[model samples]
Target: MIAYDNDNIAKVEQAYMLKTECLFKLKKKEEATKNNLLLAKYYLDFAEGIFQNDIQGALRCVNYYQKGIKLYRDNGEPQKAEIAHKRLVEIQKEIPQIMVPFSIELDIKGVVDNIKINMEGLTFEEGLIRLTQMFVFEKQEDIKNRVIGEFKDHPLAHMFGKRCT
Candidate 1:
C-alpha cells in the first residue's frame, strides 16, 4: 500500500510513472504488468486533478489517460479502460479544425500594349469583390477598363469571366 500525501502529489505521481515505465521495460518480472497498470491509473488520476480548467493541461491529461487505458487493457481491466478510451475520443473530436491559407502569384503582360502587371496580396474575398464590381456595376467602367487592358491575355481573366457568368 502506498501512503497518500496530498502535499507531495506531483512528486508521487512522477514516481509512479517512472516505476510503471521501469516495470514495463523488465522482460522476466512476475506480475510487473499488473503493477505497471495500477501505477498508470494512479498517475492519470493525479494528472487529471492538476489539469482542471486548463486547455494545455487538459491535453497533457489526455496523454496520461491514454497511457492508463493502454495499461488497463493489457492487464485485462477492459471495463475501466473503455471509459478512458471513450473520453479520449470525445476530446479528440472536440478539437477545432484549423484552416491554412494558400497563395499563388501570376504575372501578365498587357494586351495591344506591353505594360507589366502584377496582381498580388489579394485574398479570395477581395478577388471576388473586384470581379463583382467589374461585371455587376456598370458605373465602374474605369476599373473594368484598367483590368481588361492589363490582363486581357492572362489565364485568370477567363476564370474571372466564368465566375461572373
Candidate 2:
C-alpha cells in the first residue's frame, strides 16, 4: 500500500483504498493472514491518529494495539505479540497523564503547603493551565542552615542578601 501524506485528504483516501485492497487480498486465508490484516489496519489507524494530533483518536489506537497484540499471540508470533503489548502499555502510561485527573502534593519543611485548589476531574493539561492562572509567585527564598542564603552557602539561590521577613 502507498504511504501517502496524511495532510492531503485525497492521498489519505487513496491510501485507505489501497489498504482495503490489501485486506481483500488477504480474505479466505489462514488465521495468521486475518491477524496480519488486523495488525496492518491498526497500525495504519494509529499512525493516522498521531499525524492528525487527535488525542481521542490516539487513545482509540490503544484498543487496536491490544487487539493486534492478542491476534499476534494467537497466531504464534510471540515476539511480535510481546512487542505489540509493550507498545500498548507505553501508550497507556501516557494516556492517564492526558485524560485522567491527578493531584500533586508538595511538602516543604515538613509542612504541607496548602494549594487550596480543586483540581478534581481535570486532565493534566487543564490542571497546569488552572494552576498557572490561579497561582503567582511574587518572590521566593532559600533558607539554608537557618540563615539568609548566599552564593557561597547556597549555589541554588538566585536572590542575594534577601532574608525572610
Candidate 3:
C-alpha cells in the first residue's frame, strides 16, 4: 500500500498479482476480485502519468484501461466498466492519437480557461494562425516559433525555423 501511494508501480503490481493469485487459489473470490479492481485502478493512474511522454506509454495505457473494464465487469461492477469505457471514449475524441498516429491536439478550451488565451471555440489550427499573427505583429519571432512548434505535427510546423514575415 505504501509502495502504491508512493508510485512504486512495479513493486505494487508484483505484490498485488501474487496476493490475488494466492487468494483465488484459496477460494477467496471476493478478496481476489477486490485486489484486481485496485490493481486495475492503479494501472489507470500510472498509464495516464506516462502517456504524454512515451509512445509505448499510450499503448499500455489503453491496454490497461481495457483490462480494467474487464476486471470491473468480472467483479459485477458494470457501472465501473461503463465509466472506464466513457473515459476512454472521451480521450479518443479529444486526442485521436490514441487510435491513430501522427496527429495530436492541444486542448484550446483548456488554454482559454487556464492560460486565459481567449481563443475559445476555435480550432487548434485557427488558434495557431492567430498566434502567428499576434506574435508577428508583436515582433516576438522566437516565441512564435517555439509556441507554434510545440507539437511535432503542429499546424505551423513548416513555418518553424523561418523568420516570420
CA deviation > 4 Å runs, candidate 2 = 1-55, 100-165
lDDT of 1 by residue, 1-165 (tens): 145664465676566556666766876354676676666677567556755555665666677788788878877788978988887777665432221223444443242122112224567787666555544555588888877876876854443323111
Cα lDDT tens digits, model 3, 1-165, are 626444777678788889999999999999898888887787777767766645566666777778778878887789988988998776555444543434445555644464345466678998777666654355588768776667555764553344322
Work out the TM-score per prediction: 0.43, 0.37, 0.50
Candidates' C-alpha lDDT: 0.62, 0.57, 0.71
Number of the top-ranking candidate, with lDDT as the measure: 3
Q: What are the clashing pairs of model 1?
A: none
Q: Judged by TM-score relative to the true structure, which candidate is superior, 2 or 3? A: 3
**lDDT score, candidate 2, position 40:** 48
Candidate 3 structure lDDT: 0.71
**What ordering of candidates by lDDT runs from best to worst?**
3, 1, 2
